[model samples]
Target: MLVDIHNHILPGLDDGPESLEEALLLAETAVANGITHVIATPHHRNRKYDNPALAVKLAAKSLNEELLKQSIPLHILCGQETYFYNEMLQDLDGNLMTLGESGKYLLLELPTNYFPAFIFDILLELQFSGYIPIIVHPERCEFLKRDRQLCYELVRRGALFQINASTLVGENGLTMQRFAKHLIKHNLVHFIASDAHHYKNRPFLIKSAYKYIQKKFSSQYVTYFMENAKHVLEGSVLQPIPPISFKKNSTKH
Candidate 1:
């Protein structure tokens, strides 16, 4: 099954769909794009939105029921796209939701403009506490885009990277697309998710992105992402793919 590990499909939660109809429409689009499952990762602890675990679970359940009623053939699981904070451990202890609610993988978002100095320590702590942190949309982060070594270090230290499908297709811009491709070429990317928020502009791009990857890279690369998604949902160890080093000064436009 094609699973989207990151998305904002839950209605009235964050900046995703605003109503049930919009949510259903997004689900239809996702199903049409060959996505069978999506984790409704509403924003949590972000300055603008804060959806707690129990509340996101309830919303996901409601959306699932509506999908069943509408015969959408899509499943919504609970998750959170949490902004990194020192209190993440405490929040997890107090019932913060992990990706797919599996408790094995957590979807984390860093600031787009800069990387926090404390993130390394926080990632280490989370891993030590038994939760694998999956950094969301790193290609779009200006700091990481400027310094590929930061990404390598995070992945080297046991953190997984999730790239947005939109970035793969240059929807965000050419720079992000290049970085997304770089991450994939070097085996630094572990998951590819929609990060979809609406039915139109930020719609599900998994099918298109996978097609691009298959054509540009190889079928095995596509399978790599798919297997990683499966392992994430199963809370099992992912298949090993050796990462290659980024060549020096290779990110120039």
Candidate 2:
């Protein structure tokens, strides 16, 4: 009943699995982890490669064909991990980098360092342009470490947050794990994704994380995150929650 909103399961396109075999392995791992659905989010803003709209559509088609051939029951959707650069606005405005699964939700990936001032301004611009921006892996972004309020403000400004399951499982780093816990405790996170690239380093861990959260938080919150993800798959707009401020030290609290 869970859906992974971010992943690199597409074969040979990005830094994900290099072959269909690997992709299938990762897909099975995701399914084993209770992920009923996953979004194939490839790198769209890599200048070395062109992730045009048509190209992504084609990749989705190809991936579907492979999945069908392998008979994997997990449903897969299409999306892009968009780089938050100045030119991203142009691509989005022109309809290239827009969200693929829900069509209204675009996944915005910030640089690992402190968020450039322009990243915030441009996210606002995208919202003004009528697109819901899903901030990918906000916990892993070093910018959040610099100023957690920036993250809370993003949620305040009506942006959605997607934390990777790896962060919660402590597969990333201690700081990221702390941030993920903080985000979840404050209810600042709306979705959790695999952001998974491999079956080993980043095996899908939703099942374990689900048990963890369900034990700590209410099952209804777990349902909220999982169901909200399904809403994305069905192309439904997520019901927005009024943003809450961060405690700055929710990790320790």
Candidate 3:
């Protein structure tokens, strides 16, 4: 099954759909795109939005019920896209929700403009605490984009990287798209999620992105990403290959 690990499909939780109608519409779009399952990752502990685990679970349950009523062949699972904070370990130990409620993977977002000096330390702590920190949208982060070695180190340190589908397609911009492709070519990307907020603006583009991956890379690469998503949902250990290095001489400019 095609599973989206990062998405904001729940209503009134964060910067996603505003009402039940919008949520249902996004569900329909996802189903049509051949996505069978999605994790409703509402923002948590961000300065603007803070959706706790229990509340996100309740919202996901309600959305699932509505999808059933509407006959939408899509399932919504509970999760949260938590911003990195000093108290993250404490929060996860307390009541923070991990991706798909599996407790094996946590969707983490870093600050956009700067990479915190303690990021590696936090990631190590998270790994020691038995949670795999999946860094969301590394291609879009200015710091990682500038320093590819940092991304490589994070992956080597047991942290997984998730690339937004839009970033792969240049929907965000060419620079992000280039970095997304760079990560994929080096086997640094473990998951490809929609990070979708709306149907029109930031819709689920997994199908198209996979198609692009198959054509540009190989069918095996597509399977690798899909299988990683499945493993994440099942809370099983992911099979990550050693990442290849991107030679600077191959760049055009």
Candidate 4:
């Protein structure tokens, strides 16, 4: 069962599908791409979107019902792609939605251009509070690209990383593809998810991404990512392999 840990397939949630009809098309696209399960990670606390946990859960429940009614063969789990904020920890008791509603894993999105100084402290606090933070799309962050050591430290501090399938399959660009592969070689990335927004434009590419991983890396690497996604959905404890520092001369495109 291919489980996507990140996606925005719920209607009227964020920049995802505009209506239920569009969201169903996106779900069908996922099923065709070999995804059996997906976490409907609507954007929350991302300044522009404000999807509370209850609302997200209700939306996911409705979508799942519709899928069953229409025989879509896809399941939608409740989750949120929450932006890092100052009071994130405090908000956990209230409206924050964890991945799969597991409470053990949180899919966190950081600022694209800069890495905040307080992020490390927040990650540590989250760990101490019993939630493992999965940093979403670190490969796309400018600061992480400039300082790979920071990403290494984030994993060292118990934060797992998820890269987009688009990054792995070169849909985003060659530069991002290389960086995604670099992260994989150094054991920095733990999960590969679609992050799919539209049924046509930003559709799921997990099948091709895993195929690329199998070809470039190995089948074992593909299995590792696939298994990790299952463990995350089950809320199982995951002790990721320590990330090695990115040596300047060691990487090749």
Q: On residues 2-113, what C-alpha lDDT tens digit does candidate 2 reach at each position?
A: 7787888888888888897898899899878877777788887756545666667777788778878888877767788877777666775453655544557888787787
The TM-scores of all predictions, comma-separated, are: 0.96, 0.90, 0.96, 0.96
Model 4 bad stretches (over 4 Å): 247-253
Better of 2 and 3 by TM-score: 3
Give me the displacement of residue 43 in model 4, in angstroms.
0.8
Model 2, stretches more than 4 Å misplaced?
A: 46-50, 93-95, 247-253
Compute the lDDT of residue 141 as modeled in candidate 4: 95
Clashing pairs in 1: none
List candidate 3 segments past 4 Å from native.
246-253
lDDT of each: 0.88, 0.77, 0.88, 0.90
Query: How does candidate 1 fare on TM-score?
Result: 0.96
lDDT (tens digit, per residue) of candidate 4 on 1-253:
8899999999998999999999999999899889998988988988999999999989988999999999999988988999998788899998996788787999999999987899989998998999999999998898888878777888888899999999998988989999989899899999999999999899999999999999999999899999999988999987577788765434343
Cα displacement (angstroms), candidate 1, residue 34, comes to 1.1
- By summed lDDT, the worst window of 10 consecutive residues in model 2 runs over 244-253
Candidate 1, superposed: residue stretches over 4 Å from native: 247-250
